[model samples]
Target: MLPYHDAALPVADRVTDLLGRMTPAEKAGLLCHAPVAVAPDGGLVDEPRTLLPTAPTTHAVRDLHLRCLTLMAPVAAGPLARWHNEVQALAARSMLGIPVLVSSDPRHSANENPLTSVPSGGCSRWPEPLGFGALGDADLVRDFARVIRAEYTAVGIRMALHPMADLASEPRWCRTAGTFGADPDVVGALAGAYVAGLQGDDLGPDAVASMVKHWPGAGPQAGGEDAHFASGKDQVYPAGRFDLHLSRFRPSLHAGVAAVMPYYGRPVGVDGLAGVGFAFDPKVVAGLLRRDEGYDGLVCTDFGVLTDATLADGTVWPARAWGVEHLDRVDRAALLLDAGVDQFGGEWCPEVVTDLVAAGRVAQGRVDESVRRVLTLLFRLGLFENPYVDEGNAVATVGRADFVAAGEAAQRRSMVLLANDGVLPLAEGIRLYVEGVDRATAERYTTVVDHPEDADVALVRLDAPYEPRQRLPEAFFHQGRLDLPDDRREHLCALAATVPTVVDLFLDRPAVIPELAGHAAALLADFGAADEAVLDVVFGRARPEGRLPFELPRSMAAVEAHPEDLPGGTRDPVFPLGHSVEALDWRPRTSEPQKG
Candidate 1:
């Protein structure tokens, strides 16, 4: 067997042997972390069928010589396993037969938001990461990570594009649901536990490598806008909390995470740092992360940083090169490499790297340096010996009964009771009026009523308010205003006037809810939970044990006035961070309105 192919050789030795044998094109391909799609019938899709910037699978694997890929398509476990094997077979037939390292965004959550996580397709559905933050249980976070690792490895996904160590410091940030709350210490603890569970005590064949993301925290976007768009590119730290943002990443680094993904925002007020995207700023990537922090692992850019991606539907997702948008693709590629980035995510251009080396803009040694890290990860995961997974095993392990039960339990427990006026743990056999809840599930707990006036109590389900952006992908991110529309607020108030109401608001991101808090008899916040899970808590079958991960602003005025860079900055939060009420025993009370 070849030195690189031998399973017994040291990882460094195998990486060195593989590096010496690779051509310039192969080495370039290793740096392209492009997206690929999966067909419905368990086949590899070679077309750009989805809105994500995906290349033809066959061309990306064989011609471009790409080895690193990200999966964005939602598919069942069996089909995903089949598609994975098919891709592995194609890679095995390539020139040097290097194994493909497949990675995926968080897919084990109940979120259907495309910008953050895909829907849980045959995977065990748990509450979003913020839910784990609400619980603040490191052991629970570790157990959740263990389930994620098992399911991912079963389906041949070696790299987890998650465990976002970013803080939810900025309440209006669309990506808050993906982070562990606003507290730096809590986020650090959960992130460390998550990394340890995924990578274990040591990274090996049994482990799924964690890529802790958006280094230095992607929160604190100027005006609470995301950095994904040019209009929202600035990441301001007016409070001088850049160091606090960096603090969240220290535990993940200590846990020995395999990779780091930097944010796309340009630094503002960061001392001695360029006003460029974190991926293109050498001071941030090389000096701050690599030099001062002493992180030696692989660093990958956030998706579509080098080139603009045009979707199949004629929508353009502009390149998020931010402060360096004036540069050409080659120059952009060189800057990222010089900034110490090892891979270009959502970018399918291998030619950029090859051309950079050919034009002498970047050294061959730099290319080898990144290629060595990439190969080391693949070798450490034992992908060379076995990149393929058993479809039967994948079908058996993914969404298994125990795993699903644990996820459901987490969803039920992660709900935060914001306010209770002795109107909760709702008594049995009462006529209930409901909205945004499954009728069948509500029937099991209480008698269903069509109107609030005709019911003893009303259970109303609502989502945290967000003003929608008119654009395609931007609209997918829940952004802008956090207050409920006037009409909806009035409607809820009217409902409460008719009967006592129990409101369950999905708190994916913190909202301005003082008006609603005033009207609703009781209020509970959830990160992500199913109708059944919500009902379980409402009816005392399960407990609402979650505490607020971040503060809820009293008004949109408060949200706008609060400093984005500082956590818990609102002047008078309606419900401050760590706010939650204990469940009272279920008792029947007179159906009378209680002033909130």
Candidate 2:
């Protein structure tokens, strides 16, 4: 057997052996990470996707010699395992027989953000990452990582594109809910613990190599905007403490994270580097991340940064090439290769790289370097020896009883009671009027009432208000003012007047709801909570112990006035960060959100 296929050999030796045997085109394909369709019956998707072209999974495997794919959809454990087995079988027939390395965004969340994770796909649902951040405990983060790793490995997912190490420094930023809070020290500690739990002591068959993402941190945007759109292209550090963004990433290196992803946002004049996206800037990617930081791991570009991203409604978001958009496809490929990027995410443009090599714009040896790194990841994962998983075991291992129970407990712990007017921990058999909750579930605690006027207490669930966008892709990204409209706020206030209302709001965004909060008898906040978990806290079955991960702004004006680089910089937020009330032995920390 070749050194690459020999399980007894060192990972470096295995990668070198396989890379030496591969052609330039194969190497190019190896460096391109593309997307594919996974059908229910373990076959290629017949229908085309709106953004990506329709290519048979076998074509990518056999013709392109592609070995890595980003899984876009989430399915049942049985079907997902079977589909992975089928895809590996397809690759088995190709020349050199390289197994596929499948990766996915965070799929463990109960409320899935399309850009970040999958929705309701049968994976054990935990609260959004903010839940763990709210707890402010690295030990809990380590525990969550253990469960996430087990679920991913069970379904044959060898790589995770998550643990978004970017700090939620800017509360108004649309991506705040996905992050581990705004505190750099807390973020770094949790990031370290998260990596330790996911990868264990070393890379192996049982380990799921975590690709810690958005390196150098994509959080401190110019106006607290998202990097996904052209409107939010500039990632500026106005305070001149650019190194502050990297505090969370320091621990990732210490933990031996297998891979790193550079964000799509352009860093303007950061560390004397050019104003371009990190993937396109050699000074940042090769000089800063590689030489200065000593990160020798694979550096994957953020998805769709190399090519245009399309929405369902024919809106085209130009390639996030940032400073290099003027250059054509081949030139873009040359620049990326020069920047030491190991892979072009969300793209299968191997021909462009092959042309660059053929035209003497790039050297074949440079291509080999990336090919070696890619192969090493596969070999260390032990995919070459056994690529397929037992479908039966895969079905059983995912979302096991213990995993579900632990996730529920975490969700319950993530609930933060913002305010309570002495109406919580209700005694049994009270009249309860509920909205956004199942009536049958309410019967377990109280007598269900049809009207707020007839009830002793009313329970309502509210979403953190966001300005609805009309455009296709922009609509998915929750941006603009965080304030609730006057009419809706009035309705909530009126409801509170009719009866003492306990409002449990889903807080994906830091909503500006001061008026409604004042009117609400008891205002509770959830990062992501199930009906049962919220009820458990309300009825005294479980205590509300979670602290605010990010501050609730007082208004849009306060959010606009706040500096994007500074956490708790806003002028007098509604409820400050780390503000939470307990059911018993409650203590109120009054004042603006501040660092402890």
Candidate 3:
């Protein structure tokens, strides 16, 4: 058997042999973690023009010898499985016959932000990670992880770019739904369980490698804005508790996470780390995660660290260089390489890396170092042995009845009761007026009414408060102010006055709505639960075990005044963190308006 192909050899030995055989261009391709465009016909395209465009999967696999692939879009289970197998076949045809390592952002969720998390799309739909945090049971998280792992493996996806270990410290942060919660301890415990369940207690062929992400944590961003756009790139620790964010990563490391992704935010006011993007900062990547934290695994950037991007619709997205914008692109790439980052996401320019090495700016030895890490991941997963998955089995297993049921149960358990005025378990036979809920769904429990004045109870479904901004793709993120609009607030208050109103809020963010909370006969918070799941919790068929993952600020002013680095920092919160009411008829303990 070939030295690189020997199953008995140590991973280091196999990686060393393989790296020696690969050319500079091949090594450079390994560093560029670009998106692979899967055509509608299930065939691979080289470079297709689409809304979200990238080099073709076939080109990345066969020509560039790029083995890692991030799933760009969602498709049916059978077709996706078939497409995955085809891409692996392309990689198998490459010189060394390396198998492709398919990765994706979290897909087993209710909301599918096209740029970040895609909808389940023939996958089991579970509550968001924040919902898991609300449940506050690590065992449940592990169970959910196992379900996700099974579905992912069935579809030939081996790497999950998620189970984000970042805490929801900044409630208004656009990426809040991806995180566990505001508390570091809960986030750490659940994150560990997530890593263990996805990767398993033992790692091998059946395991789905969890890339525990946003290292040094992304909890303390300035103004609750995201780093995805220029308006939200600066991460400041005003309270000087930057170490608090790093605490969640400790459990992930102990569970043997396959990789760690540094966030795009530039850390400012931190003691040791430079203000450049975390990927370009050595003190954070090498000094903190590698040296202090003692991790020697793959460190990937959070997409597009090397260059700016232009959407297929002709919209321009500036590079997230953060503090390093002054440096040349080649110099910036060199900086990231020096910082101990192993992969560059969202960019597929192998020539830039090759030219950097040939010009003596980046050492060839450094390229080998990253290549060794990348190769080791492939070998450990036994991809070289067999990478293709059965499309028939995939159709049978993915989103099977049992898997979808488990997800539904999880969604029910993730609802939190915030306020009540003795109108619960939704009294059967009541006249109900529901605005956002479909009339057919409401009719199952009560007589549907046409107007609020004609009904005994009014059901109002609302989205989490946000200062709306629309930019293709960016529009989906839901960033900015966390206050309900005045018109909406007046409408909610008016509905309450006309009838006993039951408000169901989609609490993706900690909404600041004190008026409606006081006026409503009952209030419940949901994190991506379906209509069926929500009704199940309301009808006493299922119990709601979820608690508030983060505090709801009493007012938008309080949200602005509170420090982003500190959870529950509002001067007065409407609903405190960890607050939950068990299934029963509930009423406010006090009628007077008082801080939570």
How many backbone clashes can be found in candidate 1? 0
Please, what are the lDDT tens digits per residue for candidate 3 over residues 1-596?
78989988988899889888888988888887777656555567677655666767776777776778887767778888889888888787788887889898888886757777866758888888999999889998998889888889988899999888897878789888888889778999999999999999777899999899899888778998888888889998877778888888999999999999999999887777778899898888888999998999998888877787788778887778888888877888889999999998877777878998999988999988888888999999888888999989888988999989988998988899888776776656667788888889878765787987778778888889887677765887888888888898899999899888988898877898889888999899999988877776665677777899999889878887777888777877888999877665422121221111
Q: Every model's Cα RMSD, please?
A: 2.3, 4.8, 4.0
Winning model by TM-score:
1
Top candidate on lDDT is: 1
Compared with the true structure, model 1 gives a TM-score of 0.98
- Runs with alpha carbons beyond 4 Å of true place in candidate 1: 584-596
Q: What tens-digit string does per-residue lDDT give for candidate 1 at 245-300?
A: 98899999999999999999998877898999999989889989999889989999
Q: What's the lDDT of the predicted structure labeled candidate 3? A: 0.83
Cα shift from native, residue 565, model 3 (Å): 0.6
Residue 466 deviation, candidate 3, in Å?
A: 0.7
- Candidate 3 — which pairs collide? 46-56
Candidate 3 displacement at residue 58 in angstroms: 1.6
| Clash totals for all candidate models | 0, 0, 1
Q: Give the TM-score of candidate 3.
A: 0.96
After TM-score superposition, the amount by which residue 107's alpha carbon in candidate 3 deviates from its true location, in angstroms, is 0.7
TM per candidate: 0.98, 0.95, 0.96
